[model samples]
Target: MEKLRLYIQIHQLKEQGFKIAAIARKLEISRNTVYKFLGMSFEEATDWVVSLGRRRRKLDRYQDHIVYWLR
Candidate 1:
């Protein structure tokens, strides 16, 4: 997720001697996110969860009247 991308960008910056602000601007990620991953290990970064939303939850099952009403 974002954390993994942050880790990669930070490491790439170190090897290229890029400035923090410049890297942050180019990467289009917040400065705080960049800084958080600055010295973090890959495993530490990868543990982040992108979401826990009920994206696959079917609203129709919960609201039978709504489905019939809409149809």
Candidate 2:
């Protein structure tokens, strides 16, 4: 949801004539990230963000051990 909001905000700022560099500064994100997001369509961005949440992390195998340690 946060990623979706960022995508919308980036497009909105672009529509308002904000340059990529300016948008990066305003959003406190890297210029490359701004360019990457701008290059993607809204639907593409949504799919990418959703896929990210479903991707496996390297630490997944340690989940049980980590939980036990914390407890």
Candidate 3:
């Protein structure tokens, strides 16, 4: 996954003594994002990235109306 790749790249760059600001510039990502990825473990990053794809339920706004109608 692209997120995993980025995470790995951040780690590699950090290991090579790149500063956080430099990493952000090199990757064209925000410094906050760089810090976030750096602080996270690999599995944590994967879970966080995978969870980004989850969408809100389409009918969530109508749930109260639907329940009333059913009742």
Candidate 4:
């Protein structure tokens, strides 16, 4: 589902007196995800979604090698 949709659903469910676990089950998402989004305003949710999209590590593909080197 789209981030905005998920955010709206979370808030709506919460307003309707649904618990985090119930929201998770009803939405087929994880409880952690429901918890993460539960208190965010629409603007905050949008920024979070955009930030997720912008998450591009400089060496994501070499993460395992980096870890091995560090060890």
In model 3, what are the clashing residue pairs, if there are any?
Answer: none
lDDT of 2 at 35: 91
Candidate 4 structure, TM-score to reference: 0.69
Quote the lDDT for 63 in model 2: 100
The window of 10 residues in a row where model 3 has the poorest summed lDDT is 49-58
1-71, model 3: which lDDT tens digit per residue?
Answer: 89899999999999999999999999999999999998999989988878877757889899999999999
In model 1, which regions exceed 4 Å deviation? 49-71
Q: How does each model score on TM-score?
A: 0.57, 0.93, 0.73, 0.69
CA shift at 26, candidate 2, in angstroms?
0.8
The alpha-carbon deviation from the true structure for residue 53 of candidate 3, after best TM-score superposition, in angstroms, is 2.3
Instruction: Give the CA lDDT, 0 to 100, for residue 69 in model 2.
Output: 100
- The whole-model lDDT of each prediction reads 0.71, 0.94, 0.94, 0.89
Give me candidate 2's TM-score against the actual structure: 0.93
Error of 3 at 36 (Å): 0.5
Which residues of candidate 3, in runs, are more than 4 Å off? 57-71
Clash totals in order? 0, 0, 0, 0
Point out the higher-scoring one by lDDT: 1 or 4.
4
Ranking by lDDT: 2, 3, 4, 1
Global Cα lDDT for candidate 2: 0.94
